[model samples]
Target: MELALGELLDERLITLDLQATEREGAIRELAGLIDRAGKLADRDEYVNAVLAREALGSTGVGHGVAIPHGKSPAVREAAVAFGRSRTGVDFAAPDGRPADLVFLIAAPEGAHDLHLKALAHLARRLVHDEVREALRQAGSAHEVVRVLAQA
Candidate 1:
Protein backbone atom coordinates (compact mmCIF):
# COMPACT_ATOMS: atom_id res chain seq x y z
CA MET A 1 0.00 0.00 0.00
CA GLU A 2 1.17 3.54 -0.72
CA LEU A 3 1.34 5.29 2.63
CA ALA A 4 0.60 8.97 2.18
CA LEU A 5 1.08 10.91 5.37
CA GLY A 6 -1.02 13.72 4.01
CA GLU A 7 -3.95 11.41 3.48
CA LEU A 8 -3.74 10.04 6.99
CA LEU A 9 -3.40 13.48 8.54
CA ASP A 10 -6.52 15.58 8.81
CA GLU A 11 -6.24 19.31 9.18
CA ARG A 12 -8.45 19.13 12.25
CA LEU A 13 -5.98 16.74 13.84
CA ILE A 14 -3.07 19.14 13.50
CA THR A 15 -2.51 21.37 16.50
CA LEU A 16 0.16 23.99 16.06
CA ASP A 17 0.03 24.93 19.71
CA LEU A 18 -0.28 21.91 21.96
CA GLN A 19 -1.33 22.70 25.51
CA ALA A 20 -0.20 19.46 27.14
CA THR A 21 2.90 19.59 29.36
CA GLU A 22 3.66 15.89 29.89
CA ARG A 23 3.79 12.65 27.91
CA GLU A 24 0.45 11.23 29.10
CA GLY A 25 -1.23 14.57 28.73
CA ALA A 26 0.20 15.01 25.27
CA ILE A 27 -1.04 11.59 24.22
CA ARG A 28 -4.45 12.34 25.64
CA GLU A 29 -4.65 15.63 23.78
CA LEU A 30 -3.53 14.13 20.50
CA ALA A 31 -5.93 11.21 20.89
CA GLY A 32 -8.67 13.69 21.61
CA LEU A 33 -7.84 15.48 18.38
CA ILE A 34 -8.15 12.21 16.46
CA ASP A 35 -11.37 11.37 18.22
CA ARG A 36 -12.84 14.76 17.42
CA ALA A 37 -11.87 14.19 13.81
CA GLY A 38 -14.02 11.01 13.89
CA LYS A 39 -11.08 8.67 13.43
CA LEU A 40 -11.71 6.94 16.74
CA ALA A 41 -14.95 5.47 18.04
CA ASP A 42 -13.85 5.74 21.65
CA ARG A 43 -11.26 8.29 22.69
CA ASP A 44 -10.56 6.88 26.17
CA GLU A 45 -10.13 3.35 24.83
CA TYR A 46 -7.62 4.53 22.23
CA VAL A 47 -5.76 6.60 24.80
CA ASN A 48 -5.49 3.56 27.06
CA ALA A 49 -4.05 1.52 24.22
CA VAL A 50 -1.48 4.21 23.44
CA LEU A 51 -0.58 4.46 27.12
CA ALA A 52 -0.15 0.70 27.24
CA ARG A 53 2.25 0.90 24.32
CA GLU A 54 4.13 3.72 26.05
CA ALA A 55 4.51 1.51 29.12
CA LEU A 56 6.36 -1.02 26.94
CA GLY A 57 8.80 1.65 25.74
CA SER A 58 8.91 5.35 25.16
CA THR A 59 8.15 6.26 21.58
CA GLY A 60 10.20 9.38 22.09
CA VAL A 61 12.69 9.01 19.24
CA GLY A 62 14.62 12.10 20.29
CA HIS A 63 15.34 15.22 18.16
CA GLY A 64 12.33 16.75 19.84
CA VAL A 65 9.93 14.23 18.33
CA ALA A 66 7.62 11.63 19.86
CA ILE A 67 5.44 9.21 17.98
CA PRO A 68 2.87 7.62 20.25
CA HIS A 69 0.75 4.99 18.58
CA GLY A 70 -1.65 2.12 19.28
CA LYS A 71 -3.71 -0.57 17.58
CA SER A 72 -7.24 -0.79 18.85
CA PRO A 73 -10.69 -1.95 17.84
CA ALA A 74 -11.90 1.51 18.70
CA VAL A 75 -9.94 2.94 15.82
CA ARG A 76 -12.09 3.29 12.75
CA GLU A 77 -9.14 3.49 10.40
CA ALA A 78 -5.47 4.33 10.14
CA ALA A 79 -5.01 7.95 11.07
CA VAL A 80 -2.37 10.34 12.34
CA ALA A 81 -2.64 13.39 14.56
CA PHE A 82 0.19 15.90 14.79
CA GLY A 83 0.82 18.32 17.61
CA ARG A 84 3.55 20.91 18.10
CA SER A 85 4.43 21.90 21.62
CA ARG A 86 6.26 25.19 21.76
CA THR A 87 7.21 24.59 25.38
CA GLY A 88 8.03 20.90 24.86
CA VAL A 89 6.88 17.94 26.94
CA ASP A 90 8.86 15.31 28.86
CA PHE A 91 8.47 12.14 26.81
CA ALA A 92 11.36 10.13 28.33
CA ALA A 93 13.36 10.23 25.16
CA PRO A 94 16.63 8.33 24.86
CA ASP A 95 18.45 11.63 24.42
CA GLY A 96 16.87 12.77 27.69
CA ARG A 97 15.29 15.84 26.15
CA PRO A 98 11.74 17.08 25.92
CA ALA A 99 9.69 16.44 22.77
CA ASP A 100 8.15 19.34 20.91
CA LEU A 101 6.75 17.45 17.93
CA VAL A 102 4.22 14.73 18.67
CA PHE A 103 2.55 12.39 16.21
CA LEU A 104 -0.20 10.17 17.55
CA ILE A 105 -1.03 7.23 15.29
CA ALA A 106 -4.23 5.22 15.53
CA ALA A 107 -4.71 2.00 13.64
CA PRO A 108 -7.48 -0.53 13.55
CA GLU A 109 -6.76 -3.82 15.31
CA GLY A 110 -6.76 -5.85 12.08
CA ALA A 111 -4.17 -3.71 10.30
CA HIS A 112 -1.04 -5.02 11.97
CA ASP A 113 1.48 -4.91 9.12
CA LEU A 114 -0.01 -1.80 7.56
CA HIS A 115 0.27 0.09 10.81
CA LEU A 116 3.88 -0.92 11.25
CA LYS A 117 4.71 0.17 7.74
CA ALA A 118 3.07 3.53 8.29
CA LEU A 119 4.97 4.03 11.50
CA ALA A 120 8.24 3.10 9.82
CA HIS A 121 7.61 5.48 6.97
CA LEU A 122 6.86 8.32 9.32
CA ALA A 123 9.89 7.59 11.45
CA ARG A 124 12.13 7.64 8.42
CA ARG A 125 10.88 11.05 7.36
CA LEU A 126 11.16 12.49 10.85
CA VAL A 127 14.87 11.67 10.98
CA HIS A 128 15.57 14.68 8.81
CA ASP A 129 16.09 17.98 10.55
CA GLU A 130 14.55 19.82 7.61
CA VAL A 131 11.25 17.99 7.88
CA ARG A 132 11.06 18.68 11.60
CA GLU A 133 11.80 22.36 11.06
CA ALA A 134 9.25 22.63 8.29
CA LEU A 135 6.60 21.04 10.49
CA ARG A 136 7.50 23.35 13.33
CA GLN A 137 7.21 26.41 11.13
CA ALA A 138 3.96 25.25 9.55
CA GLY A 139 1.35 27.94 9.95
CA SER A 140 -1.80 25.88 9.52
CA ALA A 141 -3.08 22.35 9.08
CA HIS A 142 -2.94 22.75 5.32
CA GLU A 143 0.65 23.87 5.59
CA VAL A 144 1.48 20.85 7.72
CA VAL A 145 -0.13 18.58 5.11
CA ARG A 146 1.92 20.23 2.40
CA VAL A 147 5.11 19.60 4.36
CA LEU A 148 4.31 15.96 5.04
CA ALA A 149 3.38 15.44 1.41
CA GLN A 150 6.93 16.31 0.48
CA ALA A 151 8.14 13.58 2.83
Candidate 2:
Protein backbone atom coordinates (compact mmCIF):
# COMPACT_ATOMS: atom_id res chain seq x y z
CA MET A 1 0.00 0.00 0.00
CA GLU A 2 1.07 3.58 -0.71
CA LEU A 3 1.78 5.53 2.46
CA ALA A 4 1.13 9.22 2.71
CA LEU A 5 3.70 11.47 4.35
CA GLY A 6 1.14 12.78 6.79
CA GLU A 7 -0.06 9.29 7.68
CA LEU A 8 3.47 8.26 8.43
CA LEU A 9 3.81 11.38 10.54
CA ASP A 10 0.51 10.80 12.32
CA GLU A 11 1.88 7.44 13.39
CA ARG A 12 4.78 9.44 14.84
CA LEU A 13 7.04 8.26 12.07
CA ILE A 14 8.06 11.79 11.19
CA THR A 15 8.62 15.17 12.81
CA LEU A 16 9.26 18.66 11.57
CA ASP A 17 11.46 21.48 12.78
CA LEU A 18 10.98 25.01 11.44
CA GLN A 19 14.35 26.30 12.59
CA ALA A 20 17.24 25.38 10.33
CA THR A 21 20.14 26.94 8.43
CA GLU A 22 21.59 25.96 5.06
CA ARG A 23 23.77 23.12 3.80
CA GLU A 24 25.48 21.26 6.67
CA GLY A 25 23.11 22.74 9.22
CA ALA A 26 20.11 21.06 7.62
CA ILE A 27 21.63 17.61 8.12
CA ARG A 28 22.32 18.32 11.80
CA GLU A 29 18.80 19.63 12.21
CA LEU A 30 17.35 16.42 10.72
CA ALA A 31 19.24 14.37 13.31
CA GLY A 32 17.47 16.25 16.07
CA LEU A 33 14.12 15.75 14.35
CA ILE A 34 14.66 12.00 14.05
CA ASP A 35 15.63 11.78 17.69
CA ARG A 36 12.58 13.70 18.83
CA ALA A 37 10.35 11.68 16.50
CA GLY A 38 11.68 8.37 17.92
CA LYS A 39 12.54 6.65 14.65
CA LEU A 40 16.29 6.32 14.78
CA ALA A 41 18.52 3.85 16.64
CA ASP A 42 21.78 5.84 16.78
CA ARG A 43 21.59 9.55 16.02
CA ASP A 44 25.12 10.17 14.82
CA GLU A 45 25.25 6.94 12.91
CA TYR A 46 22.10 7.85 11.05
CA VAL A 47 23.31 11.38 10.37
CA ASN A 48 26.75 10.31 9.22
CA ALA A 49 25.44 7.61 6.94
CA VAL A 50 23.04 10.05 5.29
CA LEU A 51 25.82 12.59 4.91
CA ALA A 52 28.02 10.01 3.31
CA ARG A 53 25.35 9.46 0.68
CA GLU A 54 25.09 13.18 0.13
CA ALA A 55 28.82 13.21 -0.50
CA LEU A 56 28.21 11.32 -3.72
CA GLY A 57 25.62 13.81 -4.99
CA SER A 58 23.41 16.52 -3.64
CA THR A 59 19.86 15.45 -2.86
CA GLY A 60 18.64 18.98 -3.38
CA VAL A 61 16.22 18.83 -6.28
CA GLY A 62 16.02 22.62 -6.42
CA HIS A 63 12.96 24.92 -6.28
CA GLY A 64 13.60 25.35 -2.54
CA VAL A 65 13.48 21.63 -1.76
CA ALA A 66 15.87 18.84 -0.81
CA ILE A 67 15.34 15.18 -0.05
CA PRO A 68 18.20 13.48 1.75
CA HIS A 69 17.92 9.73 2.03
CA GLY A 70 20.01 6.75 3.06
CA LYS A 71 19.67 2.98 3.10
CA SER A 72 21.19 1.20 6.06
CA PRO A 73 20.73 -1.73 8.40
CA ALA A 74 20.48 0.70 11.29
CA VAL A 75 16.92 1.49 10.30
CA ARG A 76 14.07 -0.68 11.53
CA GLU A 77 11.66 0.53 8.85
CA ALA A 78 11.33 3.07 6.09
CA ALA A 79 10.75 6.51 7.53
CA VAL A 80 10.97 10.20 6.77
CA ALA A 81 11.30 13.51 8.61
CA PHE A 82 10.53 16.99 7.44
CA GLY A 83 12.38 20.24 8.08
CA ARG A 84 11.92 23.78 6.86
CA SER A 85 14.50 26.52 6.69
CA ARG A 86 12.74 29.86 6.72
CA THR A 87 15.84 31.53 5.39
CA GLY A 88 16.44 28.65 2.99
CA VAL A 89 19.46 26.34 3.34
CA ASP A 90 22.31 25.96 0.88
CA PHE A 91 21.99 22.26 0.28
CA ALA A 92 24.16 22.47 -2.81
CA ALA A 93 20.99 22.36 -4.83
CA PRO A 94 21.67 21.66 -8.47
CA ASP A 95 19.79 24.81 -9.42
CA GLY A 96 22.07 26.86 -7.17
CA ARG A 97 19.22 28.04 -5.02
CA PRO A 98 18.79 27.56 -1.28
CA ALA A 99 16.28 24.95 -0.16
CA ASP A 100 13.41 25.92 2.10
CA LEU A 101 11.86 22.44 2.36
CA VAL A 102 13.77 19.32 3.33
CA PHE A 103 12.77 15.70 3.67
CA LEU A 104 15.06 13.18 5.36
CA ILE A 105 14.38 9.54 4.58
CA ALA A 106 15.94 6.37 5.95
CA ALA A 107 15.21 2.82 4.84
CA PRO A 108 16.61 -0.63 5.49
CA GLU A 109 19.37 -1.87 3.20
CA GLY A 110 17.10 -4.62 1.83
CA ALA A 111 14.05 -2.50 1.03
CA HIS A 112 15.09 -2.11 -2.62
CA ASP A 113 12.58 -0.30 -4.86
CA LEU A 114 10.28 0.69 -2.03
CA HIS A 115 12.68 3.32 -0.81
CA LEU A 116 13.27 4.72 -4.27
CA LYS A 117 9.53 4.73 -4.91
CA ALA A 118 8.90 6.68 -1.73
CA LEU A 119 11.43 9.28 -2.70
CA ALA A 120 9.97 9.47 -6.16
CA HIS A 121 6.51 9.88 -4.71
CA LEU A 122 7.73 12.76 -2.59
CA ALA A 123 9.50 14.42 -5.48
CA ARG A 124 6.39 14.09 -7.58
CA ARG A 125 4.19 15.56 -4.86
CA LEU A 126 6.46 18.59 -4.76
CA VAL A 127 5.74 19.46 -8.35
CA HIS A 128 3.00 21.77 -7.19
CA ASP A 129 4.15 25.08 -5.78
CA GLU A 130 0.96 25.52 -3.80
CA VAL A 131 1.61 22.30 -1.91
CA ARG A 132 5.14 23.46 -1.22
CA GLU A 133 3.88 26.78 0.07
CA ALA A 134 1.29 25.08 2.25
CA LEU A 135 3.99 22.95 3.78
CA ARG A 136 6.05 26.07 4.35
CA GLN A 137 3.21 27.93 6.05
CA ALA A 138 1.84 24.99 8.05
CA GLY A 139 1.52 25.92 11.73
CA SER A 140 2.14 22.56 13.38
CA ALA A 141 3.51 19.15 12.60
CA HIS A 142 0.01 17.80 12.35
CA GLU A 143 -0.83 20.60 9.96
CA VAL A 144 2.15 19.68 7.87
CA VAL A 145 0.96 16.13 7.70
CA ARG A 146 -2.55 17.27 6.84
CA VAL A 147 -1.31 19.37 3.99
CA LEU A 148 0.73 16.52 2.60
CA ALA A 149 -2.19 14.17 3.00
CA GLN A 150 -4.37 16.52 1.01
CA ALA A 151 -1.82 16.89 -1.72
Candidate 3:
Protein backbone atom coordinates (compact mmCIF):
# COMPACT_ATOMS: atom_id res chain seq x y z
CA MET A 1 0.00 0.00 0.00
CA GLU A 2 1.09 3.53 -0.66
CA LEU A 3 2.05 5.49 2.40
CA ALA A 4 -0.08 8.46 3.29
CA LEU A 5 1.16 11.53 5.12
CA GLY A 6 -1.04 10.77 8.13
CA GLU A 7 0.14 7.18 8.26
CA LEU A 8 3.81 8.05 8.08
CA LEU A 9 3.26 10.67 10.72
CA ASP A 10 1.38 8.28 12.94
CA GLU A 11 4.25 5.82 12.67
CA ARG A 12 6.50 8.41 14.28
CA LEU A 13 8.37 9.56 11.21
CA ILE A 14 6.96 13.08 11.17
CA THR A 15 5.91 16.06 13.33
CA LEU A 16 3.81 19.20 13.24
CA ASP A 17 3.29 22.80 14.45
CA LEU A 18 6.88 24.04 14.60
CA GLN A 19 7.20 27.65 15.73
CA ALA A 20 9.62 29.77 13.73
CA THR A 21 10.26 33.45 13.26
CA GLU A 22 11.83 33.48 9.79
CA ARG A 23 12.66 31.36 6.74
CA GLU A 24 15.87 29.81 8.05
CA GLY A 25 14.31 29.40 11.46
CA ALA A 26 11.34 27.59 9.95
CA ILE A 27 13.59 25.14 8.16
CA ARG A 28 15.66 24.57 11.27
CA GLU A 29 12.56 24.04 13.40
CA LEU A 30 11.24 21.52 10.90
CA ALA A 31 14.55 19.70 10.83
CA GLY A 32 14.54 19.49 14.60
CA LEU A 33 11.01 18.08 14.57
CA ILE A 34 11.91 15.49 11.97
CA ASP A 35 15.01 14.57 13.90
CA ARG A 36 13.06 14.20 17.11
CA ALA A 37 10.35 12.28 15.29
CA GLY A 38 12.86 9.46 14.79
CA LYS A 39 13.36 9.75 11.08
CA LEU A 40 16.86 11.19 11.09
CA ALA A 41 19.96 10.20 13.00
CA ASP A 42 21.63 13.56 13.56
CA ARG A 43 19.52 16.62 14.31
CA ASP A 44 21.92 19.53 13.83
CA GLU A 45 23.69 18.04 10.81
CA TYR A 46 20.39 17.15 9.15
CA VAL A 47 18.96 20.59 9.78
CA ASN A 48 22.03 22.33 8.36
CA ALA A 49 22.12 20.06 5.33
CA VAL A 50 18.49 20.77 4.47
CA LEU A 51 19.06 24.50 5.03
CA ALA A 52 22.02 24.38 2.62
CA ARG A 53 19.80 22.65 0.07
CA GLU A 54 17.18 25.38 0.41
CA ALA A 55 19.89 27.98 -0.20
CA LEU A 56 20.21 26.56 -3.72
CA GLY A 57 16.62 27.55 -4.57
CA SER A 58 13.60 28.94 -2.86
CA THR A 59 11.08 26.21 -2.15
CA GLY A 60 8.38 28.79 -1.57
CA VAL A 61 6.17 27.84 -4.50
CA GLY A 62 3.72 30.58 -3.53
CA HIS A 63 0.00 30.65 -2.70
CA GLY A 64 0.82 30.70 0.97
CA VAL A 65 2.62 27.39 0.78
CA ALA A 66 6.26 26.31 0.91
CA ILE A 67 7.61 22.83 0.46
CA PRO A 68 11.18 22.54 1.65
CA HIS A 69 12.62 19.15 0.85
CA GLY A 70 15.92 17.32 0.62
CA LYS A 71 17.29 13.80 0.58
CA SER A 72 19.82 12.66 3.13
CA PRO A 73 21.43 9.52 4.38
CA ALA A 74 20.11 10.59 7.74
CA VAL A 75 16.55 9.84 6.68
CA ARG A 76 15.60 6.25 7.18
CA GLU A 77 12.53 6.55 4.95
CA ALA A 78 10.18 9.02 3.33
CA ALA A 79 8.54 11.41 5.77
CA VAL A 80 6.69 14.72 5.87
CA ALA A 81 5.79 17.25 8.55
CA PHE A 82 3.33 20.12 8.41
CA GLY A 83 3.60 23.49 10.10
CA ARG A 84 1.09 26.29 10.09
CA SER A 85 1.48 29.97 10.85
CA ARG A 86 -1.60 31.98 11.71
CA THR A 87 0.29 35.23 11.23
CA GLY A 88 2.20 33.92 8.19
CA VAL A 89 5.94 33.85 7.69
CA ASP A 90 7.94 35.71 5.07
CA PHE A 91 9.13 32.91 2.85
CA ALA A 92 9.87 35.03 -0.23
CA ALA A 93 7.20 33.16 -2.14
CA PRO A 94 7.27 33.54 -5.91
CA ASP A 95 3.82 35.12 -5.71
CA GLY A 96 5.25 37.73 -3.37
CA ARG A 97 3.25 36.49 -0.43
CA PRO A 98 4.11 35.15 2.97
CA ALA A 99 3.56 31.46 3.56
CA ASP A 100 0.92 30.32 6.04
CA LEU A 101 1.31 26.62 5.46
CA VAL A 102 4.61 24.81 5.21
CA PHE A 103 5.45 21.20 4.54
CA LEU A 104 8.92 19.86 5.06
CA ILE A 105 9.84 16.59 3.37
CA ALA A 106 12.80 14.34 3.92
CA ALA A 107 13.22 10.99 2.27
CA PRO A 108 15.87 8.33 2.08
CA GLU A 109 18.31 9.15 -0.70
CA GLY A 110 16.94 6.30 -2.80
CA ALA A 111 13.18 6.90 -2.38
CA HIS A 112 12.80 9.46 -5.15
CA ASP A 113 9.40 8.39 -6.43
CA LEU A 114 7.85 8.18 -2.98
CA HIS A 115 9.05 11.65 -2.15
CA LEU A 116 7.61 13.01 -5.38
CA LYS A 117 4.29 11.38 -4.70
CA ALA A 118 4.18 12.84 -1.23
CA LEU A 119 4.95 16.32 -2.53
CA ALA A 120 2.34 16.05 -5.25
CA HIS A 121 -0.26 14.95 -2.74
CA LEU A 122 0.56 17.85 -0.46
CA ALA A 123 0.36 20.34 -3.31
CA ARG A 124 -2.86 18.89 -4.62
CA ARG A 125 -4.52 18.85 -1.23
CA LEU A 126 -3.50 22.36 -0.29
CA VAL A 127 -4.95 23.77 -3.50
CA HIS A 128 -8.36 23.80 -1.91
CA ASP A 129 -9.20 26.89 0.07
CA GLU A 130 -11.40 24.92 2.43
CA VAL A 131 -8.47 22.73 3.38
CA ARG A 132 -6.37 25.79 3.92
CA GLU A 133 -8.96 27.37 6.14
CA ALA A 134 -9.50 24.15 8.01
CA LEU A 135 -5.78 23.86 8.59
CA ARG A 136 -5.66 27.39 9.86
CA GLN A 137 -8.45 26.71 12.32
CA ALA A 138 -7.14 23.31 13.26
CA GLY A 139 -6.63 23.03 17.03
CA SER A 140 -3.95 20.40 17.30
CA ALA A 141 -1.65 18.10 15.37
CA HIS A 142 -4.32 15.41 15.45
CA GLU A 143 -6.79 17.79 13.88
CA VAL A 144 -4.30 18.67 11.19
CA VAL A 145 -3.68 15.01 10.53
CA ARG A 146 -7.41 14.41 10.38
CA VAL A 147 -7.80 17.16 7.82
CA LEU A 148 -5.08 15.66 5.68
CA ALA A 149 -6.52 12.21 6.02
CA GLN A 150 -9.90 13.41 4.86
CA ALA A 151 -8.36 15.19 1.95
**What's each prediction's clash count?**
0, 1, 0
Quantify all predictions' global Cα lDDT against the true fold: 0.90, 0.75, 0.76
Which ranges of candidate 3 are over 4 A from the true structure?
1-3, 11-17
Give the per-residue lDDT digits (tens) of candidate 1, residues 1-151. 6787776887998899999999999999999888888889998999999999999999999999999999999999789999999999988999998999999999999987767777888988989999999999988989988888887
The list of candidate 1 runs beyond 4 A from truth reads none
Give per-model TM-scores: 0.96, 0.87, 0.87
Residue 80 of model 3 has an lDDT of 83
Clashing pairs in 2: 22-89
Give the poorly placed runs of model 2, Cα more than 4 Å off: 11-17
| Candidate 1: residue 18 Cα off by (Å) | 0.4
Q: After superposition, how far is residue 125 of candidate 1 from its true place, in Å?
A: 0.9
Model 2 weakest 10-residue run by lDDT: 7-16
